[model samples]
Every structure is written in C-alpha cells, then in structure tokens.
Target: MLCVRKSYALPTIILICLTYFLFANLPPGAESPSVNERTESPDTPDQANDGRLHFTKKSEKYPVSEYIPLPTAAPSPIPQIQYDFPPESWWGRRQRVKRQKAVKEAFTHAWNGYRKHAWMHDELSPLSGDTRETFAGWAATLVDSLDSLVIMGLMDEFEEALKAIEHIDFSTTHATQINIFETNIRYLGGFLGAYDLTNGTYPILLKKATEVADFVYASFDTRNRMPQSRWEWTRSAEGLGIEPSRNTILAELGSLNLEFTRMTQLTKDPKYFDAIQRIADEMEDAQKKTRVPGLWPLFVNAQDMSFPDPRFSVGGMADSAYEYLPKEHMLLGAQTKQYRKMYDAAMDPIKKRLLFRAMTRDGKEVYFPGNIQATLSPGRETLEPQVEHLKCFLGGTVGIGAKVFDRPDELSIARKLTDGCIWGYDIMPTGIMPEIMYISPCKHLESCPWEEKKWYKDVRDRLAKGAQLEDLTGMAKSLIQKHGLPPGVTQIADAQYKLRPEAIESVFIMYRITGDQELQDAAWRMFRNIEKMTRTEFAHAAIDDVRDPHTEQLDYMESFWLAETLKYFYLIFSEPDLVSLDEYVLNTEAHPFRRPTAA
Candidate 1:
C-alpha cells in the first residue's frame, strides 16, 4: 500500500472544507430532483432564501439582509448526562484494532521527515519556502503521535507532543487556514482519547484541548475567530455573516466538551462539565436556528447572517463524528444523559430520513442526506450543518427507542441507509470512500478543488490497489439485509463511494449490538481489504494522494479512523469484549492547545 509519503496521510488535513460533488458536477444521468432540490441553485448558500419572507422579521433597527447578527447574552451553564460502560460498549473492538495498527504505521512513517520548528511537505517541500500543508502535515503527525501515547498508555510520549502543541504557533499570514489542520480530525480524538485511555488521569489533555480549541471557535466575521477560508479571512466579528459549520463547533467546543465532560467527571470539576454543557446548549441553539432538521450548510456570514456554501462545509464535511452521541458508559456521568436528550432530539431525523435504510426512497440502504436550504436564517445554517446528523440521531432514537418513541422499523430503516451508502458504486474509485459524494449527479470536476483534473491524474499513478466495487457493495448490502445499521449512524453511500468510511466502524457496531455473524463477516472483509493494502508502513487507504503514495509511519500514528474501524471490528469478532474503549476517541477538531482562558 502507498503511504502519506513523508507528507500526506494526515487526511483532509491542512486544507479541509466541503464542496460535495464539486468535481463530479452531479453523477452520471442521476439528475432527478430531490425532495428539497430547488430550481434555483441547489449547490450553494443563497438557495435557502427563495424570496420567501422570514417567519419572524428581525428588529427594524437590525434588519436582516444577507446575514443576521447574533444577539449578545450571558453565557449559560452546561447540562449533565450520566453513564457507565456497558457490556456492549466495546462492540466494534475487532474492527478498531485491525484498522488501528495499519493507520498507526502511516503516522509513524510521516514523522520520518519531522523537523524541529518548521513544517515539511512531500510534493512541495522544496518549491518555494514554507507550505501551509507543511504545518498541517506536522500538526497531523504530532496529533497522531499523541494518540499513540493515550492508547498505548504512554502519557510521557504524549506530553512531548503536547509541548509542541502548546508552545508551537504558526505564522497566520504564510499558512492562512492551514493550521486549521490541527482541528480537522485526529487532534480532537487524540486529546480526549487521552482521558479515556488513562481512566480519567489525563485531565490536562481536556483542559488544554479547550484552550487550543479557541483557535477557530467563533468563525464568523470576528477579527480573529473567523477562519481563513478560501484564502479569504473573515475580517469582522460578523463572520462573513454565516453560521459556523457543525464540525466547526463540534471540533472545537464539541470535541473539547467531550474532554471537559470527562475531566469534570475525573476531577469532579463543575467548570469542565459546565464548559461542555454550554457548548452543547449552543449547538442546540444553532440547530433550532438552522433550516430543516437535516440541512447543514457549510459556512455562514455574520454581518447579514448569509450562508456561503454548505457543500463541503469545512468543519461539517463527513459523518466521522456521528458515533459520539450519548450512550451508557462507565465514565460518562449526568453529562451523558443530558447529551443524550439533545443529541437524540437533533439526530432523530437523520436515522429516519437520511440514513441509507431499507425505507429510503432508493432502497439500497444508504442514507447520506443532500444538504437542504430550509434555514430560517443564515447564521443558523453554518452552526449545525451536517446532513447525517439526522441519521445519527435516529440511530440513538432506535438504540433506545423504547424510551425515545420511535417506530418498529427503526432498525430496518437504519440498516438500509447504512447499507446503501456502503454499496453505492459512485462513492469512490479507491473502493473505499471519498469525503463526500452526490445523491444525484454533478459530472463536472472543476467545481471541486481536490478532485479536479489534477487529483485524478495523481490517483492514476498509484503503486498498488485491491478490492473491486462489486465486492464492497455486495457485502454492504448483504450485511444490512442480514443484520441492520448500527444504533448510532446512517448510511455511507457506496453507490459513488464518496464519504465511504463514514459508515465503516458503525456497521461493525450494528453486528456487535445484535451479535450477528453476517455483520462480522462484512467487517472481516473490510479488515482484509485494509490489511491487503498495507504497505511498508500504513494501509493504502491511509494515503489520499496516489502520486505520492507510500505508507509512512506517521500516517499510522493517529490513524484514529483506522483505530476506530479495526477496534470495532475486533470487538465484533472477539468474544466478550470490554464494552467501552479504555481509551475514548473523539474524532473532532484535534487541537494541541487547551481552551482559552485569561492569563
């Protein structure tokens, strides 16, 4: 398998955002209008307006135009949830481990080029001077290293990386949005994962994670909070007048909240718990303010609260964080319960409407939602923009449907959605999954930057490959019909193979929940495929760029996704698993720094 080289593997790292199907320009001949597809543009942000007058007009003095500014209010306290690791908690143990070691190799390999104070890269490491990807590259490497520390019970190694996380600061001008890398995927998981592994001894990770989370916290037009998106800095506190992406808050506060929630429990610190709850409340506020329950716009502006584009809404890209909903756990306390209610409420539609369940209009069992434009206002759109949040919520609703009031077919519907996503052929040529795919068709490639003409050419030169689309598709469908979607996720469209892994680990969970052999077989195949692609260091799946493919060590380090994929897989295959991962993983915006507080 090809690795992230000395450079890649940090995935969707450095520069991460969304423009779903921007390249495909719509799939081939699948142009039937969707439920919410408007004749006006269905791809960008303005489509939400459709000229209808807003239900409740804003104050005459603060009339809303393109964006709606936020009203200042005192910060509220966090809520409480409770839990204990149940027997079934670690269901996907097998899947998580198989994938973990493979991905760990990728990170270890990437670190070969690790420098002291400067960033490094593969293709462009020598071109001009410093590349933003360089910083993103190193941050991802260090982030992965930190993960090893947590899971391997080596807090000492984690602390070394922690120092870099704390002391190292990038020049905002040269890198622009590149440092946004740390907050992308692995960092959040590693930090919070530290606490989970240490049996709550790693409070520093959570506390420090919060401090670092402030980097991209506000995202609107704020002087600094707004991100350097599309090379454009959100100049004012108004945030380009857009609602922040769901991932944005989730990565920062959401991920941090997970850590703080744990810290609160470990140290019994009300402040940590308070912080997590406050973020959850804000997420709720953001959700209610958005369009339809399922729609998750990519970015929003603050000046007039106008939305930009939800299509690859940077933070809310894939459904990686879908599995973190409230569940019974040994460590989670009242925080789990409170989180469950809000998360359950927010995720309900996703399970029912978005997950690729048998009930889907297209019956293949995949349930990736097309972003909609029903937001009441712009700011709201940015805050809670995840198409699958509904499906995730549904999974939770079904997992405990007895209490949540769901339908009898909840499991059936959820299974189909998950299956369809995994079976969708258009998802990826890698036979794995890309970040995002189209429900319909967007045949043009220029619309998307990453998948543009340049990217495909890069893929063409890959050294090794395995597995065909039919194999994965067949297995996904079979698994779903036999068992069902897991309790916490929606479908991962295999039709296009885009956003493929979003549904990977959860499928293993489904099998664990029901103790079904068919699901295990499906998981076994996924593991085989990943291992088959393993190169000297990491799995081929770990490398995004084929031109520079060569499984490196760093790629494998924080391979949290792999960790999750295999861990879950392992648990399903292994008998009598421990239920919860001693190490909890938060696939969020991984920040090296702690949350902000006055010095």
Candidate 2:
C-alpha cells in the first residue's frame, strides 16, 4: 500500500555507484553541498514554559522573548480505592488461575501506593521523581504489562491506576513532553486491549481511556504542526518554545492518529479515523518543503507540514514513523488506504534510490546500516566519529534512522552489513548504541577483512566506546523491521558495557517476533549472560564486577532497560507476537483527538 517514489531497482544502482565514486575520494564527514552547517537554537536561560516563556519553533538563532501560561485543571476527583482485573478465562483458565492472585497483589500494591498523593503536591516532581502517581516516567510502556495483567484477570487494579494516570499532567521539561506523548499513546493501547477483551465493544474502561486522550488533545493543539519537546513545568502551560527538532513529537502524533483511524473502522467511530487526518496533512506539507529526494533532515520545526526544510541532516524520530507504518498498520490497521497514501508520499525516493549498502567517508550513502543500535545515555551525545554531531541516526533514512533488509535476496546480506560494521569498527560486543552513524569516521575498521567490513567495524566500535552504550533495544527494532534477521546479529550483539541488560531486552524482542530457533539460542545466551553479568545481592540488581569488569560504576540498579529486558524475555517465551503489530511510540501533546472508537 505504501508507494516508494524512487527505488534503486536494478538501474539506479548505477547512479548510486556514480555518486559514490564522485564523493568516495573525499574525507569522511567532509562537507558537501547537501550537508549544511548546523544552526543552534538560541538559549534563553531565564525564559520558562508556563506562559512565561515564548520562542518560535523554527529559528535557532534567537532566544525566547515572551511567555504564556498553561491551563489549570480543576481539582481532580478522589482517586478510586479499587479496580478490576481480567478474570481467569481472559488469559486461558489454566495460566490465569496460577497468576491471577499475584497480579492482583502487584496491581493493588502499585495502585494504593500510587493513589495516596495529590497532583497538587509536587506533580512537577516527575523531573525530581516524586512518589505521588508516576509510573517511572514511561507509563505507556506499562500499557503492555497492563494487557498481560488484564488477561491474568487483574483489570480492576489497572482501572484504578488508570484513573490516577488520567488525572496527572506534565506541563514542563523534556519528560513532560515525553509523558504527554505516552499518555495519549498508552490510552490507545489500553483502548485496544479493552476492545479485544470485551468482544469488539467499548466498555467503561474504554471511556476512561478516551478521557485521557481528550485531556491531552485539549492541552496541545494539533493545528500547530510543530511541537515543542519541552514546556514549562508550571500551572499555566504557556511560552512553549520549540525544541531542537519537532519531528519526533509530530511523527509520534501522526502515527497515533493512524492507530485511532483504524480503531474507528472496527468500532465505527468516524472521529477516531478523522482525528489524525490533519496531522497527516501537516506531514504532507513537511514532505514537499523538505524533500531531498533522499531523506528528511533534522531541522524541521515548521508549523506547516507542507514545508519540511532540507538544509539540515535528518535525525531519528521521522525515520521511525516512516519505516514502521507498513507492519504496524496490519496490527493497528495501518493498511488502510488513507494512511497508506499519506505514508507512501512521505517516504519518497529514500525508500528506493537513496538507501545505501555500506559506509563511506563522505556523508554519501555506502550502507553498513548507517549507525549501530547503540543506546543513548543521560547527558552524553555523539560517538567519536559523530563528535560535535553527537546524535546517532536513532531510527536514518528519514532522521531517526530506518532499519534495512532491502536486499532480502540473501539472508547473508544483513550479516554482511553487520560484519562490515562490527568487525571493521571494533564495535563493542557489550551493547551501547549510537544515535547516528555517518558514512565516514576515521582510521580504523582495521579488523574488517574487506573494505566494507572495515568501515562498519570502525563505525560500531567507536560508537560503542563513546556512546553511553545502554539502549540496545534498537537491535530488536532493526531485526523485525528488516525481517529475517539472524539470531546472532539480533540477539548475540556487542555492548558498550560488559554487562548489558539492554542487550537481553533486544534478544527478547528478536526471539519473540521471529520464533526462530536461532533467536531462542540467542535468548538462552542472553539469559546466561545476564546471570553472569549481574548479581542479586542485598536486595538490589547490582553489576557483576568479576565477570563484567568493564566498568566499575557501582551505583547500578536494574535500569528501565532491565524492566524492558525482562518484559521481552518473558514475552518471547510467553507470547509470540509481542511487538510485531504495534508502533513503539505514542504522542498526546501533538494532537487533541477523540479516543479510538474500536471498543
């Protein structure tokens, strides 16, 4: 359904080669007519988000000059004392009978502890980690756990917690931006699960889920295509200056609308389907203006999607939505005509012609997967090659980065690419991922047997060492996105840290989705690695110095990666189609839409 305008086919491979030849001689990271100088957004230390700060979305040259306030919610109702869990039959009587009680306990404990505080009391504490109703700042992730919980007959507890989540609001900081996205996305997840459980009908819980979406939509304006990554953490949600790039927020919103529309088809609500149309329109505008005939760059912050600026290098977010559309729609109804038309037009030539097969020194396409799936850690940005360009191509064909399997003609092709990167770049076997991998770095990849191999090896190794090396989930994303990824590349990957829980998580997703015996082998390998690398002593998830003596950093607890790792691991062994049919991101602040009508 998605139409790629310019594919390399068998002919353009020639043009790509010609382009490669012309630029191949240039030094890596050499400036091209295509790669523009980066302009930084002006920093206004004093301006803030609560209607007290104001900044334009596109201009990076100046600081915010004004401020606006956010709307204040009336005091929310008393938090519910209790909630319901799905019954034994929901998850199959056999498993439900065994785990229902445990789920009830977990949900109840989480609910009671979560419900005690008021949003009035340090609701802004998400940045500081306040106890009153926060789900580790990544609540949408819990939506998956919630589904499992419901099946295990613990929906009651979720309903109670859901009530609490509906009431809390994040109006400031990057976390606020993320939370805003999550609430909307999660509400959709919850709505879908409820529909499935209730036999294609909306229940009371569905309405509650819609309420969450409605509140988020009301808080953010869909008309304003460009969204700020951060707003002030004050009562009046004003002076929202645009962040570095708005595509991540915007794409997340657009993708969510697609989900809602498909939900509408099932539930017969025109509203859900129509909800994302405007965002889609915005995306169209963005494509026309920014079309590089290759990939969209990172500097798009326009209120008008019709005009995506091409001067900047694209980042990770946009790529995520583009490549994810096909399969995700099958799960969320992404196959619909309206959504398919929208995405196809946006993908353009990059899907076909511009996609590369190896790394080159210049920013020209050479392949090697552009960047390794290195994790971004707190504060640090960029690997050695990226240097000042700290951001890795998080998701690359568009900005966030896209996974590749174009030459599916050979299963060995993907591995060949991986080998080029891993062996050549001296990539860490320990699991840290970079946000981007440019065509060219510097002297290295000496280990690679061939030119391509050498290039990839150098790229991955430099990135792993320089990168925080924690977000290995990219590997899983790549596996499913690329399709038919071997177990070794997907699961048995390198990490920045000798001991990486994130790597385990990647293995989990890979194994769950593929159901390949190789993936199972990878999972077993991951299980053993985790056992050897981490220790459970003194009631904490601490690092194992004896085995994973890579870093001496002692203040280690199971990071969010660990939770995700466990989630995937349990899923691979427990559920087969865990993430195959869903989009990984959700954004609420980008749009104000009615909830999904599908049950």
Write candidate 2's Cα lDDT for 486-561 as tens digits.
Answer: 2112222222232222333333333332334454444444444444343332212333232133533333332222
- Best candidate (score: lDDT): 1
Model 2 spans > 4 angstroms off = 1-144, 148-179, 186-204, 219-254, 262-269, 288-291, 306-315, 331-335, 338-368, 371-448, 451-515, 527-564, 575-599
Q: What overall lDDT, based on C-alpha atoms, would model 1 receive against the true structure?
A: 0.36
Candidate 1 lDDT over residue span 386-480, tens digit each: 23322322332233332222334555554544454454312333333333322321123123112222222212212112434444445444433
What do the candidate models score in CA lDDT, each in turn?
0.36, 0.34
Query: How do the predictions measure up, each by TM-score?
Result: 0.49, 0.49
At residue 212, candidate 2 shows an lDDT of 48
Q: C-alpha displacement of 92 in model 1, angstroms?
A: 15
